[model samples]
Target chain A: MKKQIITEGKIYFPLSETLKLVIENIMKRLTRALLTMSGIVLSIAFYTTLMLTASALKYTLGAQQVISEYYWWMLFLAFLVSATGITNSVLMAVAERVREIGTLKCLGAMDKHILEMFILENAFIGAIGGVVGFIVGIIAAIVLNASTIGISSFFAIPGIEFLKALLSSILISTVLSVVMSSYPAYRAAKLQPAEALRSVA
Target chain B: MGGEASYAYTVEVEGLKKYYKMGNTIVKALDGINMKIYRGEYLSIMGPSGSGKTTLFNMIGGLDRPTAGKVFIDEVDIAQLDAYELAWLRARKIGYIFQTFNLIPVMTAYENVVLPMIFAGVEAEERRRRALELLDRVGLLKFKDHKPYELSGGQQQRVAIARALANNPAIVLADEPTGNLDLETGMEIIKLLKELNEEREVTIITATHDIKMLAVSDRIAWLRDGKIQRIEKRSEVRFKVYKVEG
Candidate 1:
């Protein structure tokens, strides 16, 4: 027998269930997911390459060097472009899934759950892009500086400093992706179920 | 009307109105409509494209707010509930089926069936058991792992029907459930819904353009120009099919 209808309290999916959905969604659209992650990957790789090259140079020369401001400005521009790309990609994704979102709403999903799903999806992409970009940057730095710094110098950089750079790159990419995805996520969550259902494609 | 205090009506709509403004003119989608639906009844709302069947369907499902008036589901005014409470109501009491068979494209048939139960916070074990049972009932247990795109239109609709019954809702709202199906498939869906309605004793309300639904519906409400033109019981209504001779 069906239970009596009661209107009280909020409905929330368990985190494990939500994570599974996020993973499944990403996996199903692997091509689009990879396309969206490309912006993060390229930008993070560039940023990491610049930072690692500078660290390698400083370590090889045994000098405390001050990086130029123009480099910082260029890095900022790269991130700006990457953020724009991610935001545009995520917005399109939300628009494409308007009907899906409506179906979810009809099945009793709250705005918060929708928000969490999108955020987690982008965060997962960000993490993957961050790690991949960091590895690429590490390889690029080694190839570029190996001949001049005698290969040993590249590895001679302090372990703590190398770990710090990796952590920072990952943190930056993840934060950038999340921040960029917020507006699209918010728009998706605030969609009225009725209008969303009526939307075409 | 007797003075008995029995709450036989499962849904009630009072003085409902919905208006949309298109530039200088106003379109009254639903105008001063009122209705009462009994528990365990099969009711069909039939209308043309612009007759506001979808609008009234949305209002009753709590998917859209009315311009005025009240919608009482199980004697509670839906507009009075907050967002969280409304979600709870939708999750626990109402099941909706759409013409397009809006199962999650990324999920398999089994996952789609289990989704509503997840929102209703059913235990993992119970959800799995019920999902498999519902799949078996729908005669799609073998195709449980197929995604929406992999299934045929009829198969997808069956999956959607099973998903709708996941949480054991008291009311199932179907909007053009057979709009995308052929005559044979549409009949199969209608029969399945009829059987489920009788077996589960759930209130089934459908907004459709299909005249075939009249055979299964206990009561049929005809809407025209944003208002109920007439409502008739199955016994009182008559049909005539005209065949064209070449």
Candidate 2:
């Protein structure tokens, strides 16, 4: 005896099982998820703050000529470290769930389904971290710039610069997350069901 | 199609061989074995620890490819199919039960039961209905919302059984299904499996060392040293069981 979820000719609130699985998986590892997010957050926050400070100082000190073009190297380094962090963390998560993947395979789940779950999980993590990092980075940039120069000078800085920094940080974190997860996702998809069972047995 | 029209067996294995290469030596897990399992038959494969019973079970379940042989399930030659075709066949035809009760730890019993249905493209309402019925049939309806960690060993195995039956598969392949449970709980599992086999006429093939399973089986296949030692009808299988006093 089960309650009917459909009314009339239409169904009410039909959710795909994959979406539920992805959400449940992420929620189950909230502590590890948060730890993984912190890496992205810290990296993006540093990148934003550095960019904002350079723009603010350019106007305040009228020293645009003194700004080094090699400053982009620091940003590149931050991006590389953050991408590596996401890859390692997602790989560890996949390693712990090898048997679960095998069970899914035995139950008829295709490689694409397993791949989709991992990508979606990392994308969500990246988005949340990016937004939070943007806010924190902007605030830090404003506070430090104000203390270094006068509050009036800080307010004089163009709003466009902050918007650019916001978009950059968010885009970088989200894209990095997806790119970094591909290898581990492929590895998970390629796992043989029998071998996976033995790994945990 | 003409060739398949004459076969009466649901699963037909011919000259199946599986060998694993470890370092420099090749271990013959299943050597030149052949088997035929008919529809609605309860067959048990019994053997000691390294006797290749599991290897045979894997070959029939489409979980592993044999070195030199063919497995035909429901008239389709599985060895001829590619990965995609094999996945489709496995999803639509076979249900697997493992000793470790491989239910997703984060999902509830109900969700675990409906997982295979979801893979088979069953709609939400139908999937829910079937999952509920299977859980109730397996006597795990009361624990539908519980996670695997929250359930007892017997309860978890019951959940796994319910999950196995979710897709209404052509066959259920159980590998040492009672290996991890107590004797009393194992008996309960056997009773449930027996009821399922009789009530639904689902083909049940189990690989195990548990003598209790032999009682309920229609045919028992004994394997030793990578070869089938003997196959006996249930009426011909006679063995003594002695209880150990604690």
Candidate 3:
């Protein structure tokens, strides 16, 4: 015998039903994040490519500048630190889940669910990217820091917190990016389902 | 209040007045419409362009409020319901099927159908069971994992029907559900709706401009210029036809 589903006027579906919707939605956002940041990623790759072949090869000041403003390879690494990749990845991820955002509202997803879904989706994406991006950025930075540039200097790679700081900085940027893009997500949530369901193209 | 009939109506509306201020002209979308819909009936609402059929449908679905009337569903005066209560009412009792078959494109067939239950705060296992069961009933168990774009228009409409029935609501408010489908597919969909009406005693209220819908409806409230021109029962239609011929 199937149990009575409704008691006291509340109707319930399975918990995973909503969770799966949310999970799939976040995955969409994550894909978008990857796309949105591809430019930045390409820029980093391009800049690294240039740095690898620059005239500063063999100069300490040149390499320091690479660490400072020019490449500031530390910047991506830094942002990834607190939770690196979070900001960029979250922004991209939420952007990707645009349709899901509107659909959830139509399904009568309350403000909290919409908010939690986007935040959690991107946060999960960020967390994943944070781990991976932090590791990669560190390796890149260390390779940049310790390797022979166009110029050479006595190089020191800290064994511990250097890694922590690098991870932390990346974390900050990821967080900042996520915070910045949340308004867009909320705006997407605020759209009338009637209007939002229209062809996005 | 409208005059009482012998039987209680599952839906009742009175003095419904809704308007939108478009620049200087106030569009009186629904002006003083009093309507009652009975249970275990399949009804269609038909009107020409600008006749406010969709507007009335929207009000009935609780997607919007009537600016100057009360909408009562199952005896609760919905106009008095707060935003949250309205939301709850929508989630619990009313099932809406749109003209476009607005299945959440992001979700698979299984997830889309159970969406309302999630909003109403159902548990996980039960919703999954019900969603699959409905999908199975609709003969789409094999296609449960497919997304909206992956399905044909007919399949999508079926999915929309399953979604509408997600809450097991007594009423289904479908707005031109077959408008986007081809003739053969549209007829198939009507057949499905008829089957549901016969099997479950579910009240189906469809708003359409198509003459085909009128043929399938148990009764029809024909609207012209936002006012109901006539309300005709199927038997009444047959009697009228015979009288005109004989």
lDDT of 1 at B22: 98
Which has the higher lDDT value, candidate number 1 or candidate number 3?
A: 1
State the lDDT at B215 in candidate 2: 79
Question: In model 3, how large is the Cα lDDT of residue B79?
Answer: 63
Task: Give me the displacement of residue A115 in model 3, in angstroms.
Answer: 2.3
lDDT of 1 by residue, A88-152 (tens): 99999999999999999999999999999999999999988998888888888788777876677
Which pairs, if any, clash in model 1?
Answer: none
Report per-prediction Cα RMSD to one decimal.
Answer: 3.5, 5.9, 6.9
Question: Sort by DockQ, best first: what order?
Answer: 1, 2, 3
Give the TM-scores of the predictions, in the order they appear.
0.95, 0.90, 0.76
Q: A1-201 in candidate 3: lDDT tens per residue?
A: 422212245533344554675577556445565654443343333333333333233243444433346446554553344333434445444455454554455456655566555555554444445455545554464466455441133233223434454455346434654564576557655554443443352
- For model 1, the stretches where C-alpha displacement exceeds 4 angstroms are A1-10, A146-150, B1-6, B240-246
Q: What is the lDDT of residue A172 in candidate 1?
A: 92
- Model 1 residue A63 lDDT score: 59
TM-score (0 to 1) for chain B of model 2: 0.93
* Weakest 10 consecutive residues of candidate 1 chain B by summed lDDT: B237-246
Which candidate achieves the best DockQ against the true structure? 1
DockQ list for all candidates: 0.53, 0.31, 0.23
